[model samples]
Target: MVLFVVAKEETLQKPMYLLLCILAVTEIGGTTCIMPKALCIFWFGFKGITVDGCLTQMFFLYLFAVTHSAVLVIMAFDRYVAICDPLRYTTILSNARIAKLGLVGLIQAVLLILPLSLLLRKLPLCANPVILHTYCEHIAVVKISLGDTRVNRMYGLVITVVNIGLHLTLIGLSYGLIIRAVLRISSKKAHQKALNTCTAHICVMLMSYTPFLFTALTQRFGQDNAAHVHILLANLHLLVPPMLNPIIYGIKTKELREKTAKDKDKGSNDKAELLSHTYSDPAGA
Candidate 1:
């Protein structure tokens, strides 16, 4: 619906909405990357993926995740400009620029994550490997690789920190600036409005990152934590945000909400008209 509405509604063809469309695409792709094989394991008899298959799946999984986070960081930048520098928001984040930023993010994800897959691909694996986790993660691949994995391990750690750390740092800075700007607004109504615009994004950012953070911390520090607990948290972080973002933005965004209402009304009218036509045509009835 986000993609559809953005494509159909000319009023929504702006930078923010375009980013939302990219996010929507990532959400769909991310879920698709993780769910099918998982469901197959649950429903059909459990089987395993081959080395190349795992690499491919790992590539897509990280690609979507890394890209999603990058886009969120970009969205934070959007919100910052809108709140902190409203006058120049249009000039700063032109549609073409946002598209380029999105492309850069995607290319960055590919460049950053492709090596991990390739690193794993080049390494030898056990004759019949089985990962403890439900999905094929990069670390899991490294864990199973039979060759010396010092480089893979170090590279993985560095990239994980760099990518996630950089994304978090930028998003935090953007929001901090946004808050300062909102606070500077004289009118209470304007302050509240600025804050309200940020509410959806704050919710989205928290939802997207909190579980993952908790899971990462638990895996790193919690010696007594259950394996299944980590697995569940990891999966939920991927699944829940994509499922909720559409609902969140739909309710919170004024233009999107108005568009949804209008679309609903239009649908109802069309249904009523079709019913009327069918009833009036006695032969058709």
Candidate 2:
């Protein structure tokens, strides 16, 4: 969070700071949205998962899931702007415009997730009372449904393909354009820097999103080990990005070093003033 705030300060001239704030908020929302459901899942077994409790968890979890995906999509767009449209990047992604788009994304995510919440609520929990994964994932919760789940399953599959697969494709396409644009630059230093920036974004995105598709795909075909792998991946999906994003972003941008230097200078001056005041006091002398 501090890194984000510092980035906001360093990139004050660009619209990148605003994007950073949006990404920071989405990350917080995405990672915490499932906490209530996860607490209940761990505290009481699936049998204890009441109808209302399950629905409530499902709602927020779904909201965060969609929001998380949308934030990632927005990040890709940010990259596109930085790489392909550098000339008008500030004007194109003005603070007001970025905020409006973010608001739209948040609303769309809520609208998308709400219907899933309602759909899942209508289904009855069957006699079998085990959720295979550590968290309250939609598939894990639905696997034990007494009523027909074909509709839910189909919808889930469609969403996964669209949200994960399609989004990834678009990100790839954006990078392709970015790469092409960078190559057109004759300056070797400039080209390498551009590539480096895109590389960091790609690495972070792969780490964040690949395990998700793996877990989702494995759940359909794999056996006992699949559940454990999915759980591990889910935890990784939660843990790794938040841990790495700031570091990767800081290094990629080169702004953290500048901010750190400024902070250290400020601290030294503050310390010098304190020492001067201490010695000036009669009691101290």
Candidate 3:
């Protein structure tokens, strides 16, 4: 649906839609990195993965996760500009600027996760090779390492603080400004409309981050929970946002809904034309 919007809708060629497209693609990438292996484990009983393969999966899992979070931060900024400074939004968040922001997010996610792979490569696995979860995760893999993981832990902390902490703070601050701006508007209808515009994004943010926050907190502090519970929340955090983001946006955002409807009508007309051409007589009967 997002791809369709990008391809067909000329009006949606703005930065907001471009960011949404990137986010949709990123979400797909993130979930694909883990879900296939998870399904194989469930259906085919193919649970074992090579160490190098595990590391690769871990890299992509964190890469996409970090990228998605960064994208959300960008989105928060986008919303802030759109709502708080509507007149300057076009000039501020031009296509080139949006592209740069997207590139930065991609690079940041890659650079942050790159060190994890390098650190994992250095660690000697002396514990049981079996990974309890459905897919490879950095902390899970690090826990089984025999060598000193102080540096790995420290780097992990830094990564979490930078990626999650910084992004969340920025998002919160963006929303804070957005709220302040919204309140300044004297028209209640405009205020409501502006808030409505942000609803899908807020939902997507909550869906994407809340479960991950829970899982991370549990992993760091709540050790008494069952392994299955941890795995379940992890899977939810990785999978649910991707699955729900489009749905939430489609339902909540008027433009997306209208575009989808237009696409459907266009598809139907194209199908009808194809049928007419297929059944029409060669002799112009």
Please count the clashing residue pairs in each candidate, in the order shown: 0, 0, 0
Clashes of 3: 0
- lDDT (tens digit, per residue) of candidate 2 on 145-193: 8899998888888877777776778778887888888889999999888
Runs with alpha carbons beyond 4 Å of true place in candidate 1: 220-224
TM-score of each: 0.94, 0.83, 0.93
Best by TM-score: 1
Report the alpha-carbon TM-score of model 1 versus the true structure.
0.94
Residue 72 miss distance in model 2 (angstroms):
2.5
Error of 1 at 119 (Å): 1.2
Candidate 3 per-residue lDDT over residues 189-246, each given as its tens digit:
9999999888989999999888888888887677898988888888888887788899
Please report the TM-score between candidate 3 and the true structure. 0.93
Evaluated with lDDT, which candidate comes out highest? 3
User: lDDT per residue, candidate 1, 175-271, as tens digits?
Assistant: 8898888778799999898889889988988888887667666655675978787678778877899999999999999999898788889999999
Ranking by lDDT: 3, 1, 2
Give Cα distance to truth, residue 172, candidate 3, Å.
1.5
Model 2 clashes, total count: 0
